[model samples]
Target: MSHLNVNFLGIPMASPVIGASGTVGFGLELADYVDLKKVGALSGKGLAPTPWMGNNGVRIAETTSGMLNCIGLENPGAPYFLEHYLPEVKKLPTIFIANMVGKSVEEYAECAAMLTVPGISALEVNISCPNVKVGGAAFGTNPKQAAAVTKAVKDASSLPVIVKLSPNVTDIVSIAKAVEDAGADAISLINTLLGISIDIRTRKPILGNITGGLSGPAIKPVALRMVWQVSKAVHIPVCGLGGVMTGTDVVEFMMAGASTVQVGTANLADPSAMGRIVNELDEWCDKNNVRDVNEIVGTLKA
Candidate 1:
């Protein structure tokens, strides 16, 4: 098997294949089905300064080539995660990343500070949350607001911060550059595209939140383009996700300049997606005569 090891923001990963946040549910949930050790890292569900029950009514809806989710960052809050979740997560051999989201800059900083535990390898700041301080626009949509959030979280946490940028922005490159300049250690792009689904019969929305973030193969192309663009504009490592369902998709993301790729919606369809992707990536590398996976990163011509 070809070597699939990757150094993601100074954290050693056995493979670049990771279980994306919101899909993996803290590494241990899928441990029974897939060998967690074989995977590179597990991005836990979005956590806030306080626990949330999530949005009421329909939380998920199916689409043509994707799915919409309005889970609303439902979790037991940061304190519970540090006390309970972190201990068990520590038992897993792979790297552990805590996905942090907040309603404001202070909450974001608080969450980041709380997640600075020994077992956690990194912090993935979900900039998709609304910036209550700046009306309702997402912190990631504006470069200044995004930088403010990044600076706040970076100041609070000793662990490397990976800011997850939203694809909803008008110009993703600007947001990526802003976060990078604000001291983000790494970047993860194409969080989810704003989408809507309505029931024709009842003349009503499908999701309780009326609008939800779309994921799956439908957004892969857009995600790829943004990852390629941002990777060129920034110096930090880029982690790519969106509609990744196969090993070939993993190869494509890496070729486009992603240091690593995350498995999101695919986990909902197939529990073994991450492990399968890791194996498939190794096979693809060997067949292509590539000895190291890192060689494929940013290898795109022109």
Candidate 2:
């Protein structure tokens, strides 16, 4: 067997596979299907300072090799999570990261401050959210706005901050650099790509929000390219996500420069996906004579 342990953003993880936000649902939901201890970490669903009802109507639509969702970041609010979920989260052996989302910079800071309690290891700030104060444009699309949000959360929380970046932008490196310069401890990318599915017969959009974030196997190439680019541009560790499915996929991302990887859409297909991917990664390392998984990080040949 090979060593799969990793120290990501100062948090010691047994593996490098983290449960992507919005897909894992607080980590406890998959307890029956997976041994959560084997996984590196779990990023709970995106939480706001207050509860959000999320989108209505058809919120999800299937695509060729992926899915589209406009779930609208619905959650029971941070107070509820801290009161009802934190106790259970503390019981889990692995690290628990709170994924924060907000409509404004202050809201993001507020959410970060609220989740600074025990049991949560870090904060993954979702900059993909719209900045309602800025005409509803996504904060991740603008370099300055992304930095402002990063700075706000960094000042608000004592825990490490990992700003999650959106892939809808033209120059992802600029946004990554901005967040890093603003004191982000680490970074995770690329958040789901903006996409839409159509109901051909109905002659209308398929999702309730008319468009949604796309994820799954189809985005893997684009994700790897971005990860390779941003990792080279920023000094902080990069946690890659998008279309990671199997153990080999994890290795690919690591070689492209991700220190750790997150499994999103795959978990929806197989609840035990993270655990299985961990085992597969171990097997690959052993077969390839790789002693430690970290050795492969950013080892990509020109």
Candidate 3:
């Protein structure tokens, strides 16, 4: 039998396939489509200190191979999540990771500070949101800020913290190492690359915010490259995301050094994508005579 059990920052997952933040929305929406408990874990939507109305309309636009989103990280603030959503999400059988962000470094620490209360399995510090006006780039684009933000959250929260990395930087590996040195338990990288799409007919942007993050098959190559480089650069576990659509894709990420892989746009294409991918991974592992999935980590000979 395939040993599907995997540990990310000490959180045990039945498999390494987690539902990416913003896509899974706290694990409630997909309960009707598939039993979320069967997957590895669920990363909740971006949570701020206060509820946000998010960006204007035209928030989502479909491209030939991908999608642009200007959702602006719209979400109910942190306190409400701890009081309400956490209770509901806690009832589920899967591991729960709170993905959070804010305008300043203190906000990120504050959001993570109280995560030890209950219902949250771990904290995924969201430093990669490109649509926001402040801290997204503040923490992600620069190595010093990234490490400083990670240190703040790590000092505030007892819960394991995973700093999500942005791809819109010069040296992603440097930022990854910074987070590791700052005491982040793990790192999740390749958050949607900053991008925009314009409608030539109207000569206006397709997304409501005029600019958004690009996700889907278009980002796979870039994501894989970063994951490969960052994995080798740091000692902490790396969770990879970006354009993963098949069991083969997850395997590639794992081989390239992803301790776990999260599904974002792929889940948007099919709500049951995580479940199907889990099943596919199981079959592949069995056929290949692989025992522990960890055996594949950092095996990318290329």
Candidate 4:
């Protein structure tokens, strides 16, 4: 098999495929089904400064090619994770990235600081959370707010920060550049697009939150476009994710300028998705005569 290793934000990964946050459940949950060493990295579910109950009603609903979720970033608070999950996570052979979520700039920074332990390789900051100080506007929808949150996290945590940008923005490049300029070590784009699904029989929204983030093959095209655009605009590495399911999808994202890609909903569909994707990616590289996966980054042609 061709070399599938990659360096993401200065951390060496066995493969370019990482388990997306909110799907992998702290990295160890898939231990029984997946050979953790074969996968690149595992991004734990999103964690806040305090525990979150998530949504009340239906938290998930299946769509045509994807699914909608309003899980509300549910997770045990950062303190609990550090005390309980981090110990076992440190023993894993692969890299571990902590996903941090917050309702305010301070909460984000606090969570970042709290998770800055010896085990974690980096912090993936989810700026999609509603900024309570700004009337519930998502922090990622505004370039300035995104930059502010990036700066705050940078100030609090010594770990490399990867700001996950929301796809609901008008100009994704602006938001990407803003975080890069504000000292973000890297950026992950196209966090699930905002969507809604309604139950025709009941005449009510399928998700308790009414609207939820959509993820699956349906959003792949939009994700590739944004990753290509942002990679061209910023010097920092772009981690592309939205509807990645197979090795071909991983290759497509990397060609469009993503240094790494995260597998989200695919994990929900298959417990061993990341490992299978890594194998497929290796096969693709070997068949294509590509020696290193890095050779394909930003290789997209006009």
Most accurate candidate by lDDT: 2
Q: What does the lDDT come to for candidate 4? A: 0.93
Model 3 vs truth, CA RMSD: 1.8
Residue 279 of candidate 3: its Cα lDDT? 83
All candidates: CA RMSD (Å)? 0.9, 0.8, 1.8, 0.8
Superposition error at 196 for model 4 (Å): 0.9
- Full ranking by lDDT: 2, 4, 1, 3
Whole-model lDDT values for every prediction = 0.92, 0.95, 0.86, 0.93
Model 2 Cα lDDT, one tens digit per residue, 100-198: 999999999999999998788999999998899999899999999999999999999999999999999999999999999999999999899999899
What are the models' TM-scores? 0.98, 0.99, 0.95, 0.99
Off by over 4 Å in 3: 129-137
**In model 1, which runs have C-alpha deviations exceeding 4 angstroms?**
none
lDDT at 230 for candidate 3?
94
Candidate 1 lDDT tens digits, 1-302: 43888889889888998899999998888988787777889999999999978889898999989999999889999998888888899998899999999999999999999989899889999999888888898988999999999999999999999999999977999999999999999999889999999999999999999999999999999999999999999999999999999899999999999999999999999998888888888889889998999999999897
Clashing pairs in 3: 58-208
Worst 10 residues of 3 by lDDT: 129-138
RMSD of 2: 0.8
